[model samples]
Target: MKTYRIRKPKIVVIGGGTGLPVILKGLRSESADITAIVTVADDGGSSGTLRSSVNIAPPGDLRNVLVALSDMPQLYEDLFQYRFREEDEFLANHSVGNLIIAALSEMKGSTYDAIRLLSTFMHVEGNIYPASEEPLTLHALFEDGMTVSGESKIAKTRKKINHVYVTNTNNTDKPKAARKVIKAIEEADMIVLGPGSLYTSILPNLMVQEIGEAVSKTEAEVVYICNIMTQKGETEHFSDANHIQVLHQHLKTKFIDTVLVNTEKVPENYMDTKTYDEYLVQVIHDFKGLRDEGCRVISADFLELRNGGVFHDGEKVVEELFRLVFGAKY
Candidate 1:
């Protein structure tokens, strides 16, 4: 007999790239209404290249989120994820997911509608939307007065992001927030952020003014899932406190109430190696720093990676978050 559970609270996860998908996978089991707000500023690889040549929002992050929410039917998901390998060929290195999204966007007359249609086909459990409808180019103005254009270049340069703003500021067709998304935030038991690249994945959505504001006003207790490792160029030497500080700086609100940090220690052998050790992030000891920022920190053993590499155990992370929200560990 099938036992029906009470509908879980809505969850709005804002970010782009690989990290958002992982969180989606874990939370899907909880049956919360999920809404993913993806960054559209990519201009590298398949997504960026397509955005530049085709003049549409990059579909890479949106593709990843769609797949994560998709029911795994073995070949079904595999077929969607497969990328061509041969260089110089027409479809070289482009994800099948990206191609599918791009084609749907063209046919439907808008990227937003296309994703909605694709979600139906994939049978994704939750909703996913790009942060904006009009394509947004990520432009970074460094403190030294030099400006870096494009998400890829800005990500690689070893500079503190002085300021990030979108191009085509005149375009007013901001993607309507999924009605479910705003409702989810308002009704959510909790909201989770990060465990991904700060500037690339986390901050890009916050850079969108409306999205940032929505986060500020939501009644849900906002929980930041801090990244375990620092990106050398982007978040160099950033402690958990610094990460929260950056988000607070950008939003100018008391949005983040609690931070979930990984306190698990990686094996010494794993840390001493070069390639595997490259971006290893350590836990922040500056509890006082976090306290100053008006957020309480919860440290736990939340590290694990299914596809390999260091990542917060999404299922476990969600478990912790759910416990915090409901006031009892599940």
Candidate 2:
């Protein structure tokens, strides 16, 4: 039988944390080529414990991304995400997937290889690349001359963040992306930046030397997904424009070609603070500032409240991303 091959649009999605998986799940439903470049600077919770013990690239975010794009059964995915709550001392609250990634990383000699192997085993629909092959440490410089050495500690300070950068954990050297990550950006039709923490999750990937430079110089249309609400410690009282401005300042260039902002009003006292305590307030709008920086702002009712938390509607955001990708060709 003569078979026809499909040509999927090359889409490069960046960032990590809880946000990347939401969008990835949306994109998984579409017939498109996706390459998720994830942040490896995570230093909290289960990821932190693993990183501190075995020196693997914190696998929590990557694990979530892997499951998000996997076509496996729900049982398998759940098992991978399942955390140990038993009386096991070393494995308390650690995920099965994280341990698997750590094991593969040690066996394969790098995180890149481990992820590639897992992707194939999971029958993942898209590519997942770590921002760098080696484990990275995130360092943030605050506006008041305070510097935080880890991603976990940066937000706790609740101080004004000036800029953030990453270095390979074993040596004092500038971190660089794998060649695959660079090629993915160079060839992508569209590059999506956010829906994650500004300072901790998103910028860490861009701060890598080659990856940031590629993002700045790539001809692809770069899009930023504005968060629905301000984070307590990282982005307290930040406006939509403030988020984009911070990215511009860090990259030292106006790389974002477009921004997706939520316009729907968050009802007062609608969110249960006890359930979702990380959120502070709705992000204020600054349309003038967004336009001044040459961003094509597309605002809509992108807000969706579920599980007592406010989030960007992945379906709506993906629809806008498709529109921008189609426009970029013309």
Candidate 3:
């Protein structure tokens, strides 16, 4: 029998929030090696509550990432994602996975270590890393020259977001990326950012000094999966180009080589306001501006309407990604 060396393309995805996991789950079905670098600046709900009392980095995003990559059965994954209802008092709105990660963090001495242990035990198909080992506070500078701090708070205030950055909760100390994160980026064949909230979820991870620098300097094909809808607080009327511009401004470079955009029309008055109210409008497109920033745009009807809400078609998105990775003559 002849053994052939099959090199799986190393794909590193950097972002947090619910969107990251959708793409990860789709990618899990493909033949690429994946590494997810998740943001730790989540200051909302179970994550925020835990961060406030325990001083561990919020485990919400990390928990979701671990579950997405896990090859475990649906029942186990559901158990991990189970959340206590509002009437539960002390445990109200807390996810079972968040509690598990918190307990593991306490046992192992750090959130990064806890994630690694959980990843192994869950038989996670890919590596999931927290952007920073320590808890971080997100500070956003609004257009009015006023700065608001905290991820949850920023989302509630409908201010014109000037820019956002992250700071270690330990005063002036700068946060550092784990060694594995840097290595993964350095060795990646393709690096993907977003499909998540631009400022809150995606930028938080890139703001980490070393990780940002590594992404800026990496030789891989950097693809950005632009969000399908405009968010109210952070990006109310942002064009697709505006989103890319903001990312470029934050990273201090036009590192994006390709942009995947959704061209499907969202039916007017379709999204249920009471449930998915955070979404404001469909993102407008500016192909010229995207080209000006030196990006090859690949626009498609990547929409999936379910539960009267807007979402990226994960299977379609994965198809495009596969074409880029395996078929592109780059």
Q: How displaced is residue 231 in candidate 3, in Å?
A: 0.3
Q: For candidate 3, what is the total of clashing residue pairs?
A: 0
Pick by TM-score: 1 or 3, better one: 3
Candidate 2 whole-model C-alpha lDDT, 0 to 1? 0.90
Model 1 per-residue lDDT tens digits across residues 1-330: 222357566677888867788889888877577778788877889997677666677898898899899886979889888888968498898998888888888888778899999999989988888877767767777778888877788867777777676654326455344334566566666777876777777777777666677788877778898888777667778888988888887787768989888888766545533544447466555678888999988988988843346777888888777777666212
Candidate 1 structure, TM-score to reference: 0.90
Give stretches of model 1 more than 4 Å off.
1-4, 169-184, 269-283, 305-308, 328-330
**Candidate 1 clashing pairs?**
43-48, 44-48
Give me the runs in candidate 3 sitting further than 4 Å from their true place: 1-5, 328-330
Q: Write the per-residue lDDT of candidate 2 for residues 1-330, one digit (tens) a residue.
A: 211225667899999998999898888887779999999999899998888788889999999999999999999999999999868787898999999999999999888899999999999999999999877999999889988899999888988888998989877777889649999999999999989999999999999989999999999999999999899779998999999999999999999999999999999989989987888899999999999888999999998888778888888888788778877864
Stretches of candidate 2 above 4 Å error? 1-6
Candidate 3 global CA lDDT score: 0.90
Query: TM-score for model 3?
Result: 0.96
